[model samples]
Target: MNATAVTVFHRPPDAESFEAWLDWMGETAFAAEGFVECCRAVSDDPALEPGFSVTFRSEALVNEFLDSAARSRVLAEGEALGIQRKSSDLVIVEGELPPPGVGVFHHSVADGKAADFVAAEAELVTLSATFPGFEGVALFCRGDTGRWFSVLRFRTAQHLSDWMRSEQRAAALPALRAELTEDFSVVAHTTPFGSTLRTVDGRTRVTPTWKIAMLVLLVLYPTVMTLSRFLGPVLDENGAPPWLAMWLSQIVSVALMSYILSPAVAACFRRWLDPVDGAGWRISALGAAIVVVLYALTLLLFATVKWLHYWDYNR
Candidate 1:
């Protein structure tokens, strides 16, 4: 059965930011699994909260996305924009945020210069709007501690980083810092694993943990053993210290893993390593069993073969 999830969200303080995020989200949502259509709703009355609705091919698919990491990560961004949610898929915002985006950290304004900072912030908002993926900015004062905070929302991390590092921002920093008691701060995500993961039918799933572990072991073991067997002796004979030799060997292994073996290995086990394509418990077990057999055979070969062990002690 087709399932529809309608989410209601409070209006973001920065309407421009919310609108930009919704545009980005609409593009992302269309790529999700079982996607039917996504529609937006805006309320004319300021008192009513704005919202959006999403439809999926099945209730199950909608449920799956709600449980996925991608949604959680996106929701965290929306919340940073002064948005509140009922804990479901897709905030309509009638519009919302992508992650706190850069210009994320709050700066302590210079004492008695709060008004100056406010003026400076407006200038920044104007400047930021010219950039691609620039969402909107939210500025407010914390009631409890009475600190000034600003939230900038961008469509993606790349977009945010670009703005933070732009020459315009660099030039504006002197003025921005003049209004702040402390240096401007930025927080960004730097993890690379997310790029390796796949987003299928608009939902993303990480390969099962056990499957990943086995694959890593499968590639890493041979990469390390072969390097030790071949390269270790050369380094040792050339007056390289043990640590230096090990470091060199490690460099080669990592290069192989990053550029060669990891990609080749992942491709070889494509079906087995896929959470969506081969996710059943039976398939998982079968894949794991094969790895176990290989492990045993590898151990036997390394142990029984006399020539492969020539450099074992030297390594």
Candidate 2:
């Protein structure tokens, strides 16, 4: 991959139509050459307005997509919907394209803490580079809200997880936290796995980090167990190397998590995940009941099938 190209658009008043246009554009870009990923965000403060951003692998590809008929149609639709194009800039990112695990962190800083926060953030950036799989970090402060945003790229999800769980990061958190007016927000874009959650209006609503972690654990545990207990032996019988077998198993696990398990879990927990005022306890209870039922059914299904024993595999 080459450099990343970013384009920003001013949100339209017709949120539904704008979102539909976004959906179409994203889908079309996926089919285009050198398309990496795209995401949109609506500013919490209405004065900042709402917009979307896209990252492409190269400038040539970006131009090709921009000059294409599909993009023209999308633009026409946006114009018809009264959407305004604010500004578009293409950045030729220097150095190698970072790995799959990319994420953005948005922080609302307290008054008078902007300079101090930037200084502390600079130190953290240096420290983060020393950790494994740290690709690079970019920091930007919005003039409107004085909010600080950091974009981080890591080699893989495991690498990102390792950094998140590191004691160094924990130790660095308090200094950063003291500068924040509210809880910091983070959104990941790990290729197929870290896709953004969007509302019907095309605004990005990042799922709370804890909820995402919990959902991953729920899907990951069974995936690993089943793959190891069953698929491991089959791969071994076919004379595949241990390392390759393990890699293949992981590939399957990620695929299932990305395509099947994550979506289902998100749908089932949607009410609790995005709760309305009075629906909290009811949604919680219902989510818990559904989880219990699913777990019970999974246990029952696995228990009846004796093709492979869960604990029989050698490490």
Best by TM-score: 1
Q: Which parts of model 1 have CA positions greater than 4 angstroms off?
A: 1-196, 200-202, 311-315
- After superposition, the stretches of candidate 2 with alpha carbons farther than 4 Å from their true spots are 1-99, 188-271, 274-315
Evaluate model 2: give its lDDT: 0.64
Please give each candidate's TM-score: 0.39, 0.37
| Pairs with steric clashes in candidate 2 | none
> What's model 2's lDDT at 236?
90
Per-residue alpha-carbon lDDT of candidate 2 for residues 1-315, written as tens digits (9 for 90 to 100): 344444445646877887788788778777888877665543333323345445577767777877789887887877888877755443434222223455556799999987677667766767778888876555555555767666665677677667777788879978888889986755322223332342211133544565456557667777887898988888998999989999999999888888887867765565556523113677656765666677777777667876545665654
Across 1-315, the per-residue lDDT of candidate 1 in tens digits comes to 455555656677887777776675566667689877655543333322355556677767766665667766666877787667532333211101223333434577767886677667777777878899985555644443425545555677677778876889777768778877666533222111111343322234567676777877877887787788888888988999998998999999988887777777676666677666577888878878988888888888878886788555554
TM-score of 1: 0.39
